[model samples]
Target: MIPELCDQRIRQFINGSDFVLAMNEDNHVFSWGDNHCGQCGRKATPFRVYLKPEVISDLNDKNITHICCGFKHSLALTTDGQVYGWGSYYEQYQNAEGSDTRVINSCENHYKSFFEELSDNPIGSGGFGTVFKVRHRFDEHIYAVKRIHKEDEIKNHMEVKNLVKVRSKYVVQYYNSWTEGIILYIQMELCEYNLQNILEVKLQVFGRQLGEAMDSVEYLISCEIFRQVLESVQYLHELNPQIIHRDLKPENILITLGKAMDCVEYLISCEIFRQILESVQYLHEMNPQIIHRDLKPENILIAENIRNGRFVKLCDFGLATVHDKRVHYRTTQKHTADVGDMRYIAPEVSQGGKYGHKCDIYSLALIGGNIFEIDLFNLELEDTNVYSELYQILNEPVYRLQTILISMFRTRLWHRRPECSEVLSEYNEWSIDRNILANDTRFDGILSILQSNDNHLFIELSAIGSGGFGTVFKVKHRFEEHIYAIKRVEIKDESEEYLQRFYNEVKNLIKVRSEYCVQYYNSWTEGNILYIHMELCEHNLQNILEVKQQVFDRKLGKAMDCVEYLISCEIFRQILESVQYLHEMNPQIIHRDLKPEN
Candidate 1:
């Protein structure tokens, strides 16, 4: 067996003869062994000793996303899309320092004075100091002012640095930060409602509904919130420093309304949820990686009257830190930081055992469970024993899907936990197949659009194909004992006129059954999502063609554009028969779109 390397924190490294360089998850390049030519992005002096891991501060603001160490020179790729070089420069390292600045005009409409507030009741205050809602005089745009006390300056500089570095819709934006000797003033985007307040409101209104299954509306709302939080954390992990929000609680996040939604299109929330999962999926798949040690309900923000909470964002990076994301398995050494929320902290994190991104996954699972039970938002539990709720979440069957998700976080064992991407995939899917199944299930090999016992009757598996209109998934029905492909078509417009056309097409599809054509088994619509089940084929034409190409290459010693004469003849014959069958219908049916996939 290969031995595991102790250098788990290094994102990537390059070895060279004279010197060896390593870049950590924090995006700081560490050079050691030898630095004969100042290849480590540092100044050379007569008594300079080239040794252990030292940060290349010049590339700090650039937020270097990637790095490449050359024999005589090194390249630092920043997140801003600019490339900085150091070492045996093409002009001595291309001066990777202040070259990043592109000066703006003398008088930009940016928030310059956050210190001066028109009306100061003060919005909120904490260890960071008081925050007040402020408006710029020139632009007349409203902004939030976070006034940090003078004593906290030296200690909180890193947090200030992170705010200025990151720019994301989910994360609160930073406008300007300044120090006036005694105090530090920061101008940032204003969030009207904090997540903690929103959670309380949500619980107060929807607490009674916990016993019943969440409707499409509630599911979509929760999903959107979950997605944004994961995405924001993912963004922080991808940064050069690979930040982890150690204090991810709802009180830290803020929400704003961006758009207005009408009464008709609540299903559009489906799209919003997908966008969130995609962003988070990108985060879990990062190299060095990021794990938010603090992931609780308080960190999740929801926008009010904004498309029914469509535009949510994650905020608060107070206890955020750049950790060694490269480390996978827990180390023998214990981490004794009381950083995260007590209820949501992963066992590994709580026990001081070394952990990774899965810790964030655990926290998110707890948050999801708490949100489902409405226990996460209720302020009454703040003074009461929260452990009972955590215990119930662990033992009770209140959240079936959440129980499955929370299983990952029950122990300190890293191998037991699911990745963020996996959780996102399963959660984003429609799990209320039972409700749909209750409506119908009279069909055969094509499982009924919705069988009476849908959960037991059929299982929707992996995706087969995707198109502009819909996506197709490979599925199997337990009763039918046959594999089938189901197409989930998106309803473009919710009107009888458009729906009638779909019904007519389905009616036509059902009647013209033939050996030469794909056998259509079922068709149905539930809400906006549509389903069309059909017979599963051995292979698609593309796969068949590729296999045939490989065979021809071996036998004939040359690649052929088309298949063999006899095989091509059979394919053409089948195609013609299918076309003929379609044409012979009552009113000749014409397929406007025809390709290998079809």
Candidate 2:
């Protein structure tokens, strides 16, 4: 038994003039021995011998059912009734149809019979190849035909092979591929435009300005487009042999348009940063991680989806790299430095050091900053001075986003940076805090818990107040029927420092024993949220003052009534006494949240 065929379990063997073809139990084909005239389906010259069997990887998924060999030639038959032949039997394959064999030949005459070029001028041209508009003779449907000049005789080009392996709604669809003369032709789904065109149109509308930020509507559309792109990347990263789109720029991504909808509204706010991080998270989580070393805005494409409106298609995998499994962390070593655009490449990559999937996260942060028009100066600098310009122009939301971006741009301290999954989680919470998903149906399950349930002790009456820390709800005990206030604070950060602050607040509440102070009855933790039950007050200081103003209007202040003045003095005295009581504690507890609403 041949050692190479031992693992695969050889099912059948056929002999050529000086070579041998073996069919495995899995329907895979392997060839070896004399490879003269390419009978072995491998690159070889006359009399060249392959002592060990080499897999014909091109036909791995063909489900080859039978193999036949002729003098200096070979052929394989697949279960789907298709025939594939290579080597010296060129002329005989012309009449292969007569024998009921559908040959996957790509000769000049065969290509002309199947596809017809529509125009003399090429539709698009890039580093990979030149694209032309072509129509299938039988189906009469137009397709984008990419004609790549044969530079390498490696059977399959990287882009074509990657495209054939990927099947995603957000990726450009591959139809067919063939070789004609010295050119490789690939048929793909046609798109009207690319993301660059959209950006150009937006720039034109803004009078060719560069730094102008997109309005909320345009930003939302951009977010939707990026959401699909992230999903496509996630799909690639989840593949058995993970794929990385080494060249992730705008030009590679194509756009398709759909019918215009009337008065459409977006209920869920799209967090492009979060979506991007989620995609990268998948890549980093793989056993042998994949890294998209080249990631920029140019690689992102906008496409139309029938069910979801405008979406993004992530294209171009020419530079994607999978990690070497030999490494402990599955990181790639000796990667080509200065491979991607200077603006988006990570410091570790540009500096020619060992890097992992975190490099992609760095690129993602740069792209996120670009989408929001956040300027990142000297991104390689390990200081907040890189964000000095951002502080001057950005508002609160942008400020928070840039802070996250800065964490990703950790320069040489990349290990200290948060993982893509952590970044995504932070952004998810950010979206919720912004009330973007206030009406989102997905949150209905959590909101439903506010009603009387077996897990909860009280039934919520109403939302009394809400602030950055938590939301206070008026609730009645299910068994006791006593009204009380319950403050529910989501536990976003589980760090000891954050939890210590929360515990300290609870401690202070337990220690205080004053009639003026809100009495804390009990506290508990459930599902990443802290719940505190306290004595319910009829009105807060602000509510009482507002009601008093409405009752007297302008008359009370100007007329200076004695009864109203005395009531206001008593309220002020109580507030001062509460503050005094807290300060007089052994370890004085300062009420930081002392606003009127509190």
Candidate 3:
């Protein structure tokens, strides 16, 4: 077998009268076998036979969608409607006036011949150029075409270089780029809305407040969007001579709806098959990390039109930097100091100090705080005071989402900030831990039993008791109509000894099935909180003592009498028997604080 043929993944194969043609998944055309009458689409030789497959270089210029063969010729149809033919028939008109010239001319400006601007007005514009929505004439698929003026060639070329080098689904897809006279054109995958637009719309819906707390659904969506953004940035960082998007803000991120192309192309009339999406992966592994000096909300884009699921795409690599790890650190002396947005720029960058990839993490910290509606600290303030304020905010109770941000908010202490991978790993751990309470099937029984008549589950009717370990709440199971005392405990940050003691209490409840002991129902843990469901008693010993004293005063008008003494003696006897039951066990269990409250 031909080594090249073996390496290429052939998507389609065909046979001509004296030759064979194959189109690979990448849309590159290859030919083997007989080369008679130029049917092989290669240099015509005297022998007219080729055992090894050779790729047709001309067809590679276009995205050949389909290929077919005639008796002594082969034809290729490009995505742009242009048809290419080779072999004896084309040789007949090789010397015809303008026929050969026309073919050469068509290949010269393939971009112009295939794509046309959909509208006169550009969809987006920046310092380098205006971006227009264009449609491929043959495929009729829409794309974004950025037209950059020659005056901004440096920035435009840098962006093109980075976009072409990085191949990631989270990053905006790059197609083709070319120079025409004084303008440079770049074709890219089209996306609908940027994060800036999404946040503005959300702000309007939430009473136009900047720090308005996002509801549960909105919070989850924000987490997903932010996670994708992190993934894209991580991709840049992972690249050797890492790419740093010095400009990462909400305006640069785009969003669009998922495509239904799979359904449109399906031939079978089955619902299950129609839901599948075209499989493609754009992952590339490399050494080092990229620094996006200007990392903020405006640089992120979201695509809703994806077949699998909607995701955010990173764009505008104009301010990105390919930082080589050999250099160790980068100083702002060679670059413009005021290039990034003032609000999102890291302290080191703004202060003209040496900086590195952690700058992006600092920006991420601020963006994360904004996403969770946490108050944004004053960036211009002294690092000491700012960190102090943050410390105070963290001292109190906070959402797990906000806690992750703390590790990224080292501010002036850039080294303390965690890398993108570390931060993402921690965030994923927290997310999975919390999800167990709701999604794990093992907790379904406890969850179902905790439901109450109110809209919320696990509603506490009353606090029946309290101790060092946890609190006991009087609750009623909605479906079972059974009242149960549920003990809620905070196990987070507790010592191993404390945890072991708590588990011992639970074990004792389970093992001792005596009538004197409280009945244990169920137990479960959610995140840091531990819960135990037990039988709810109507009254404790203290309540009984007070009630008996009141009855005696009303009836006999005196203190304790002979009959009252006998009643007290019986209560004492039961307490002794309960203690005796514990002592009888091989490994005795002790009630350390045996009082009326117990």
Best by lDDT: 2
Off by over 4 Å in 3: 15-20, 32-61, 69-74, 86-92, 96-118, 126-129, 135-143, 147-189, 196-221, 231-252, 257-598
Off by over 4 Å in 2: 1-28, 32-52, 57-73, 76-83, 86-106, 152-156, 203-216, 238-242, 256-598
Distance (Å) between predicted and true CA of 125, model 1? 6.0
What lDDT score is found at residue 317 in candidate 1? Answer: 53
Instruction: Write the residue-wise lDDT of candidate 3 on 1-598 in tens digits.
Output: 6687886889889998767899988778888876656767766555554657888865554557899987767788865466777766654554443121212113547667878886788888877788888878777777888888888667877787677577478788877665666777778888756788777766543233677675433455578789988888898898889888998999888875333222111112111111111000010012455566665667765556764543545556677665555655543333345457666676666656666666766667666655444433311222333221212332222334345566566434777776555544444333323332454354555455455323234456899888888998998776567778899888867789878977877888898877979989778777677788889886889888778877776454656788888998999999999989988887887778798978
Model 1's lDDT to the true fold? Answer: 0.58
Residue pairs in steric clash, candidate 2?
248-299, 249-298, 249-299, 249-300, 250-297, 250-298, 250-299, 251-298
After superposing all C-alphas onto the true structure, candidate 3 shows an RMSD in angstroms of 26.8
Q: What are the lDDT figures for the candidates, one per model?
A: 0.58, 0.68, 0.64
- Between candidates 2 and 3, the one scoring higher on lDDT is 2
Candidate closer to the true structure by TM-score (higher is better), 1 or 2: 2
* Candidate 2 residue-wise lDDT at 410: 47
Find the 10 residues in a row with the least total lDDT in model 1: 100-109
Candidate scoring better on TM-score of 1 and 3: 3
- Residue 377's lDDT within candidate 2 is 35
Give the candidate number with the greatest TM-score.
2
Candidate 1 residue-wise lDDT, 9-86, digit = tens: 777778765666677665656666455456665554222455566656555434567777666566766542445665
Clashing pairs in 1: 26-240, 26-241, 89-93, 249-298, 249-299, 250-298, 250-299, 335-352
Per-candidate TM-scores read: 0.30, 0.34, 0.33
